[model samples]
Target: MTPQNPNLARELSLLLALATLWGSSYTFIKIGVETIPPVTLIAARTLIAGAILLAVLRHRQVRLPSDRQTWRRFFLQACLNSVIPFTLIAWAEQSVDAGLAVILNSATPIFTFLLTVLITRHEQATTRKLFGVIAGLAGICLVIGVEAIGGLGESLMAQLAIIAATICYAGAAIFGKNFRGLDPAVPAAGSLISGAVILLPVSLVVDRPWELSPSAASILALLALSAFSTALAFAIYFRLVQTLGSVGTTSQAYLRVPIGVAIGIVFLGERLSSTAWIGLACVIAGVAAMTMPRRSEYRAAQSAGNR
Candidate 1:
């Protein structure tokens, strides 16, 4: 659908909301992994978020798919969306700074665009999208400041893990389109349930979470992450996959960098460098370029000629 469609506006707004939800997740994750082992932390995240989504589904009288094939797809989505990426990010955060992680992980749209053009051909590969990718990357580099790059070469292994997780996210955005026929919450809930099932056993075996003593702050952070970041965010995410297509939906990756910085400004009394202000503008422009419907560009060109 074109950006002129009213629904597209709502979807774009949802995209911004999704960015805000996920932007705060790094802080929550950093706090959560302090005492809780990565496996245990992510296992609980999926479990809690899945349960919440399931409850919402039930409230809406929606049921998850019962077929084996659908469940298999859900399992794969779980791996790409949560089971692997979640654990990787949580583990990496132990050694990697959140700034570097955000900058590296924000490359999801670029990967999504490449994968679409090369493998899936799921969406149109327009020049606008290509520009969006370049601009978004530049914006992220500026938003985090040059100082953040100092950690890049230091935590080589952990930095690599974040990139791996970013790739998984790219795959998830494309694959998630497969669930278009189902209610957004159905796949969201199903995937999280699948993730919990996969990770719980591993957490039990590896972390022995029963013996661990987590701080109250960490526990609260886990709850916030599970509820806001995972449960609610996945519901919105799946909807955007249906409405916005993969590349457009993944533009939220660019939005999250600036949103995270804004969160810091409001809550932590942080000030943005001039570069960061410029980065915020670039991010807005990049997201616009990525999401602006082709028809809008045509209308603008026609109007300019008439003028």
Candidate 2:
């Protein structure tokens, strides 16, 4: 379907809501990690989200795939989308500033574009998509500023980890196409369960949560992150992928930058420079250019004028 199709409005709304949910997650992670270990934090996040989704599945009567192959694909998707990326981002946030981390993670669309073009070949890399990717990256750089790069040498590993998480996210977006026939909520719940199962033993061995005491604030943050960000956010995400395609769904990365910055400013008392404001403008423009459908009539009109 074309981007300008009637469904695009609903998709864009869902995209914005998903962005807001995920954009706030960096702040939640930053708070949660101050006391909670990364592995334990991730385990808790996925398990809690998984449990809630499980309840929803039963309530809605959504049947999960009993077939081993589908379950196996679900596990791989869990690792790529949730288990690895979530853990990496949590670990990386232990050192990296939340704003900077958000900026780095915004590279997801670029990775998504490349993977779609090279590996999955699920979506054609149209000129609009290519330009949107470049413009989105430029907007992120402008939003965050070059000064943020000065600290990269100090947090090189952490920064790289976040970048790696973005790569995994890109891969997950493409790989998720395998579940097209399944209910979105089914995979969303199943993947979280898979991630939790994978991380549970590791967290137990490494963090030993029995010995660790977290603040009430940290506990609340973890709950919010799991409920809103992971559970609800991902359900919407998979639905978007089925409808909008990978490029369109991954385009939420661009929206996340601005939304993340705004959350920081409003809640964290962080400041945005004038350049950052300009960058937000660029992000809006880029998203419009990329996602807005090219009408056949408009293309024909332009062709006739050129001829």
Candidate 3:
């Protein structure tokens, strides 16, 4: 099968949608975790999201992959992409502020770039791409402010957990390349199902969710988290990885910082500092640079120009 070429407009829209979906997830997690344990919250999120995706698959008559190797890959993807990161973020947020969490999570692209260079070789290392990653990270620090990094030393374990989650996210993006030809939803559904399988038993033993009573608000937050943030977001994420490759997909990390800030400004009546506005601009520029055609593509275009 021919590689699916990236459509700038469509992919940008999807990226924005995904960033918004995920950026808002912190809010839901904060609300839900007030009454629900982290493990239980994660399990509920994945299980419900997995069920939703499976329902959609059945309606579309898309059979889940039956091959053992594909199933193994799906399980590994789930561990890296959802279970580990989601659990870590949820637990870390119990101790760390959401601002600090976002900052640490924003390091995903840097890890992704490093993995691509060292292990995957799925994306070539270019100076432009490296600069973009650095600029985007700098933009995140500006947008969130340097003060958020102050408590990093206090909550050493939580901070490290968040960073570890970012590494898993980077790995998942690269590992997901193996699913290029399959339906995007298949890998997404499979991953979520695998995450649910891994987390449910633990949640049952640890949280005993059935014995705990949760508030209506927490329940609704969990529902939204599962439906919008996990299921739908994962579907789009897999599609983006297939079309744009790992580095490009993980560039959404930069996009999430601005989106989160925008949400706060618009919905919570929060004001952005002058630094934040400038940082947002830098993020846009960095993402554009990162996603721009590579040197090979540029050279091919130049040669065609002469021809």
Candidate 4:
């Protein structure tokens, strides 16, 4: 649950609202994919979201950043956040249940922590952080359990795909944190637009959305997926990043888990074992523990105050 605050409640409310928006999207995706192919669904979603963002940016005349360096940064950000993870998750969700897919996605921060340690020397991993990750991973394992007794059954590859997606999400998070100094809107728009350009042709070659039967409901769902979930989601996410630094902003992951579980139960009628419930609690606690400011950070703050 999002904690209440006087000044920050509005933002907390908005973050929770975004979580809900994303939470409900899994159901929409499940429905859309019934009649539509994953490639078509994703292509339509990405392009539509890109078009909407382009229109908004144009209306506001928010001149796109033209510097070569900014363009490079934008390109990498798009690859990490959209092109890679989006495709992996879209395909993975097709094989795995939505609830389980989200459980896997929650590993994004753990991957992010590992990636940051490798890529950024200053953001060294701490003992508590390391312990927290291990605990969180144990919690995830408990939720998924040692189902390996059942061979590649049907979803072995699918589960692996979701894990890959989480890894992509980790890379994206680190990329995002690195780009925090730039205009959030610039990279936000760039990512969608570039991603669409990258995926459009691939989608056509594979699913050929043109040949697929088109109907009003499917079209509307695709639109909502793009407009609300992809486009607006990024906009709100970037805003949160601007308002709250990386650590504070990522608190949304903890919130998204329960919301996803609730959505799964309400819409998909998915069941969660009591063990899974306990695992979920552990996951949240572990994440909270990992991300909370260390005593050293607070002590440094106090020293600055004294100075």
Candidate 5:
């Protein structure tokens, strides 16, 4: 694919949409976790989202693969993508500030890039991508405010947990490439169903969810988190994984920072500092650098278009 490919623009737009869904998820989670235990909350989230996706599949007359090998891969994707990371972030959010979580989680593209260079060799570690990684990280620091780092050392374990979750997300993005041949919804639904299987048992054992009474607000927040953030977001996520490649897809991590700040300003009457405006520009530039076609591909595309 090249810069002239129309799908490139559409995929990047979907990438931004994915970032927006996930950016808002932090607010939902904060509210939901107030009355629900982390394990139970995440379990319910996977359950509801998985069920919804399955219903959509049924409505479309699509069937999940019954092969043991495919199901096994789904289980692995679930562990990396949802079960472990979701639980860690949920638990860590109890102690870690949201700013710290945003910064740490936004490191996914960096990790994904490194893993590709060192291990998978699945994608090129181009100069543009490296610049994107650095610029995006710097932009996140500015957008979230430099002062947010002051609380970093205070919540030692919680911060570490969030970092661990970020690592898991990177791994999941790389691993997700294995399902490129399947429809995006297949892996999205399969992984969530697998996540539900793993988490529901743990929720029963650890949280005893039946005895808990969650507030209406928390329940509503969980519902939104599950439906929009998990189900819809994952579907978009898998599609990007196929269309954009892992590093390109995870660029949404950087995009999420600005989107989160924009959401705050719009809905919560929060204001941005001058640095944040600069950061937003950096984010847009970085995403463009990372997602734009290579110069050679661009030249080739232009030549082909003229033919």
Candidate 6:
């Protein structure tokens, strides 16, 4: 398929990196929280990520959302994109597997596409995009296997919480679309700060972090989560969106699972059932079909124009 833009290949590469890096986050969070309380981990993650990004943006002479209105927009974006989803996923991880959580989180694109159309008159869904969405979910079903139903079992509440995480992701996608015109660093910094604002208070109240002493290793891991996984990764992502458009860049989630699963296996010693592998294939196929450019068609049109 022909890419929509000349720089699409480069954007895809960046998106791939973004996906792989983010995939590692599930493992990092899991390990870090072992030594630190989950709420406190999230709160620390947000603040550190926010501070580093804001400082770097300032160093680069990049101006962010200066006005109250823009800050508010960023605030809402953070709530949907980072704060809410991060909190839900962190909380849900206590009960769910990393692979299961990410597989479910992969629903973001489908929800993003639908939310885009419902929210914006211009971002209407096309047949290809719709099919991709349907096939993608079907793929997830295959990878996880029907056995997941039995595992999810009577713990319907936990399953619902994971689904709720995806819903938050969908909301974030819609909110992120509005960031098209802003500087990538602007929203990156702003949303993180917003996340910190909300998470800190809640974490302090619930975790009562003063009562629990976290180890140095967990603190280091949390720093990596903020620096490599959260802040830097987001910069690469928003930059890709600028080059490839949000729809194109968002497709990166397809690649995230394999990398995430592999990381889980190697670092966390995760073992997925055979049914889950098949499900993974389905998810990958659907996302690939949706994201790949129709190069043959673009070439034919180019030839016709030459004639």
Candidate 5 residues 1-307, lDDT tens each? 1124335668888999999999887777777888999999999999999999999999999999999999999999999999999999889878765556777889999999999999998787889989998888888888888777677888899888888999999999999999968989999999999999999999999899989999999999899999999999999999888778899889998889877666666654655667998888888888888888776776765677578
lDDT scores for all predictions? 0.88, 0.86, 0.85, 0.67, 0.86, 0.73
**How does model 5 fare in lDDT?**
0.86
Task: Name the regions of candidate 5 deviating beyond 4 angstroms.
Answer: 1-6, 264-271, 298-307
Q: TM-scores across all candidates?
A: 0.93, 0.93, 0.92, 0.80, 0.93, 0.86
Note the clash tally of each candidate: 0, 0, 0, 0, 0, 10
For candidate 2, the 10 contiguous residues with the lowest summed lDDT are 1-10
Please report the candidate that would top lDDT against the real structure. Answer: 1
lDDT of 3 by residue, 1-307 (tens): 1123435567778888988898888777877887999999999999999999999999999999999999999999999999999999999888876656777898899999998898777677888888889889888878987676566788899899999999999999899999988999999999999999999999989999889999999899899999999999999999988876788788888888877666666644645556998788788877877776755665664576566
lDDT of 6 by residue, 3-96 (tens): 2444445556777788888888888777677778777888888899999998998899987767888889878978876777777777777777
lDDT tens digits, residue span 1-307, model 1: 2222235577789999999999989878888898999999999999999999999999999988899999999999999999999999999989875666788889999899999999998788888889999898899888888877666789788889999999999999999988977999999999999999999999999999889999998999999999999999999999888877889989999999988767666654555667998898889889988887777655764565566
Evaluation by lDDT, superior candidate among 1 and 5: 1
Better of 4 and 5 by lDDT: 5
Give the lowest summed-lDDT range of ten residues in model 5.
1-10
Ranking by TM-score: 5, 2, 1, 3, 6, 4
Better of 5 and 6 by lDDT: 5
Error of 2 at 306 (Å): 34
The lDDT, on a scale of 0 to 1, for candidate 3 is 0.85
Q: What stretches of model 2 exceed 4 Å from their correct place?
A: 1-6, 296-307
